[model samples]
Target chain A: MNRFAGPDGNIETEIQKSLLNIDGGIMNILSTVIRKTILTVSFVSLLPVITLTVSAQELNALVWCDHADDKLLKPFEEMHNVKVNIKTYEGTGAALSIIEQSAPGDWDVLVVDAPDAPTVAGLGLLEPYDASTLPMSDLFPQLTEAPFNYLDGKRYTIPEKFGYYGVAYNKDKVDPEDMKTAEVMWNPKYKGRVAVYDYYFPTMQLVAISMGISPDNITADDLEEIRKRLLEMKPNIKMVGDIVSVQNALVNGDVDIILNAAEFVVSGLMPTLPSLDWNIFEEGGLMWIQGLSIFKDSKNKDLALEFVKYVVSPEGQSRLATSECYWAMPANSTTQLSDAEREILRWDEQPGYLARSVPSTISRPEIDAKMLDIWTEFLQK
Target chain B: MAKESKSLKPLHIDYTRWAFHPALWFTICFFIFPLAVMLAISFWQRVYGRLSATWDVANYVKFFGSDYLIDSLTNSIEVTVLTTVISILLAYPLAYILAFKVPKRIQGILLLVAVMPFWTAYVVRSYSWLLVISENGILNVFLKGIGLIDQPLEMAYGQGATVLGFVHFFTMLITLTIYANLVQIKSSYWKAAADLGAGPVRIFFRVTLPLSVPGIVVGAFISFVIAIGDYITPQILGGGTDILIPQAIMLQISRAANFPMASVMAVTLMAVVVLVYAISAKHMKMERV
Candidate 1:
């Protein structure tokens, strides 16, 4: 301090200090800009990844059209912030084939008819549902203990809806008194005037029931007899179709009667036609129950179970039942449905109607893989 | 003699020629690889609800064993043969008219009319025939109004309806092929034949028919292949009585989930089509020579 203490020394020391300060400031500003840029780039890159992760967490489900209402799933979706994807199938077999092909976690939840649940479960496609986890008490008592969903007391499916499958005819062309039974559909009088479903199982079952053979004990021999009956009915049949074409035929008077049709078809057509009627045969008709199932390989098991719980909930069942104009019989025993709503759904406890509504006595025959081939061959011939 | 010659140098191999070629490997990966995989799948076995790699001939054996399958194959052949013959017979006259009789100004319009159906969906065209032939259809109403019959003829879902549908759909292609050949045929050749004292039929057979053979051959081949593979038309029109190969394959895959069996049927059908095409190609070559 004594030796370098001069006017020039003071100025030099001050200039060095200022230069150091500027250098430090420039470095700090450059580093901050670089860090911000990196953070912005990283956030942009992570946008799709984050979105995919969220979406993957959502349960993916495929169901038949008109099976469930979309709004019923809003609460479940919102609760877990998970999306629910519902794809509809035209027919049970069509839905089954898709599930079979895309097996092993392809779908989380499936809406299979009760008849198909055992078959699908037998194929090792369905996972055992945890009853304790869901509100099992809210389901309809009949479905809660239905044989279709229970295999050795383990429920693979939750029964969702029940309906009757039989003849749906135009009231104008076919008198209600004359159409007391499904036998009139095959009468020679309606030759080339009637419509029937082309599917083998339903058509064959209807013919079997009409012939006084319980559909439950159908075998290959029974199929042969049924085939002969079908051949007999073929000349009188104008067209074989599903609900849409059948309804169209009924409304347009293209066909007088439709064989092996569901009551919902008649219900839907009643508003427009108002003259259409449904008939349950004396031998009884096919009582179908459709249910919900979870795939064995579902990644979002919790979400799927939660969604199933919501579907079987009283509110959800009512929503589905009201919207689809069909019965969403809960599997739970305790869930209460109002008398007005039950009346609207035509849930009268009539002994005659209930007795007639017994599920088709037709045994779910072990479908021979070769049967379709054989049938196609016979039909083609 | 001592001068070096750059023009006489041999060309070098250009290894980098395909450096920028995008479709070179893309086409192979997408088309060829999938075809190879399909071929491989056709040879695999299905056992106990699981697919195994054990190669077997069971699928092929099963396909050949079924009378339904054989019937479908036979039906496909019969339909194709009928469609080809009918299309040729109908197309030749129209082609002759367009080339030798119609004015040049109307040829474009005529050709456009022939090709107009191609713009529509094949299914729509097939189903439209239903409305034309059904009991409550327009054709029935008109026929009944004119007192042609006491009852509406059940024309839909029958062999006759199927053949008619095929003829309606495929005749246009045949006409276009024949017409293209007809336009190319020189008028000078026909005039020369006439000048040499040949009659109309003789000139047509000697020059016109022989020259139009290539077009006829091409059209017939295309029509035959298309008709053979067609399942939708036969399904819509052939009634429950008629079965086709595609339908059999569809039944196997869709209803039975027997993909191996379906693959076998598909491969067999492909083989049959290829064999038929080879025979036709040979015949065409001989005719050309």
Candidate 2:
């Protein structure tokens, strides 16, 4: 600068120095922005893996298809920061077979038939639980400390969901008044327009009710009368199906009436097909209560217990009631439901329905075997 | 000298023979071993949910004693026989057309088009048939629009519906098999028969039909075995008006957890298939090609 510039301060040199300073500042800003962008991208990419690694712990349960819905599981997942693994089964027999084939500690929870609670616990598969930890005060009162929840005087399970097995029909296609009686099942007017539920326990219980016998007191001697009635109803039925198939048959106009239908079938379809509806028959209906129990070999018992508590809570009950797989009445009386949902589920009529309904109980092995035999014969006939 | 000659036998070996025995051992370990377990279980008793190994033949006795249960066997055989005969009658002509009438250049495309329905899920295919034939289904809707009938016909969910579902699937299988056999029949054989003063009808019965007996028997035997053992078609399409043996077996396993009884039913089914195989093996050797 001394050799090329004049005393008055060389303007060219000054301008060059200012320009270089500005360029250097710009370069510094660009490097900082690039570094931050890479860091943010990397952190965002690894979040799920980090979450999974930290919450690698999972609670495994054997449940029905209703528990497969994410709306019922997501809030709990977010709260506990844990994964829930579930396997669905059709009946208690299928559930037992699955558990027998699994290794110890492979399952953390079980959702079994309420009547099967004692029998299942007797096998030493479920652990005894303290009753006071749960919000028992919020339950329907009859569900808490009920005979079905105890085994040898120890509390082992709690009712989570319950509904009645009865009939659903297209109100316009079939007379709503005729549906109140079980005798309507075999009426010639509805011939080739009826769908029977394929399940034996409840269907047989419905038949027992029609025979003036209680499902809880069914004996080997009563099976013949039930068999005759079922055979008489066979020709009137167009199909025998599970919950979904029978529901489809009714909604698609293939059948006008469904015997052994429950709220699980008609709840979801009510919005689209306003004609779909259900009611307990005057002859009688069997009430089914599904309960949740902890496994003795659960490695994640603490988390599993938390999950059970969540499942019976008001918010959780609302979610489970409207689960995507199907819907049933929540066991919690204080469950949150809109006015419309309450109307659809017939909330106001539950007291009368509950009083008239019989628990879906079964007989001892010998009598049960006889009942199944008669049921098989009825299917063939 | 005798010791030296015995020592120098050159160790003759066959590598292919070594593999054959291992494959047989593998089959025995996987298939025969499970069958043996099932046989042992059939004698056991299931009281409540517990499995008791006390040996007895009560399950087999029940199968033979109960008329309703035994009737499932008769239903299975009747349904399967009718399905096999109907499929053969339907598939043979279509197979003949494809093999002889269709040009060879377009044969591959035509075969693909023919079997296109089978490319769907097995369960979905049965449901598709149900949708087409149900009371409110496409056919009924189309017919009702044209004033063909006042009431919708009951064409779905019965023994007839089950037969229709089975025939729809098995016809593809039988057609493929018969088409293979038909193509293998040389045109020169038909020419020789024509030159021998044999009319078309005589040539058909004497030459064409007799040569294809193995194909028909093989297809029919396969159809009989599979259709008899299947549970889905009868359960879905038979409308619970009738029970098949597999449905009865499922009732035991699915709800009762009575493996002993289920195994008895399964073994009885195996015996029936074996009897059919024994009868068919006299004339049709499926492996003789």
Winning model by lDDT: 2
Among incorrect, acceptable, medium and high, the docking class of model 2 is acceptable
Which tens-of-lDDT digit does each residue in B99-215 have in candidate 1?
Answer: 778899988888888888888888788767877887778888899999998876777765677889899878889888888887887789888999999999999899888888878
RMSD of each: 11.0, 8.1
lDDT of 1 by residue, A144-201 (tens): 5767786666789987766666777777776766566767766887776676655556
Residue A17, candidate 2: Cα error in Å is 36
- Candidate with top TM-score is 2
> For each of the candidates, what fraction of the native contacts does it recover?
0.34, 0.55
What are the chain A TM-scores of the candidates, in order? 0.71, 0.84
Model 2 Cα lDDT, one tens digit per residue, A1-381:
565555666977665555558957655676788999999989999997888899998889899889998988888999998999899997787898999999999999999988889989999999999877777887876666568789889988988988888988998998899899988877898988999888887888888888788887877788888888888897788888767668767766789998887687898888777788899988776788889999999999899999999999999999888887788889998998988788778877877787787677656787777777887887785
Worst 10 residues of 2 chain B by lDDT: B280-289
Q: How high is the TM-score of chain A in model 2?
A: 0.84
Return the TM-score for candidate 2, rounded to 2 decimals: 0.88
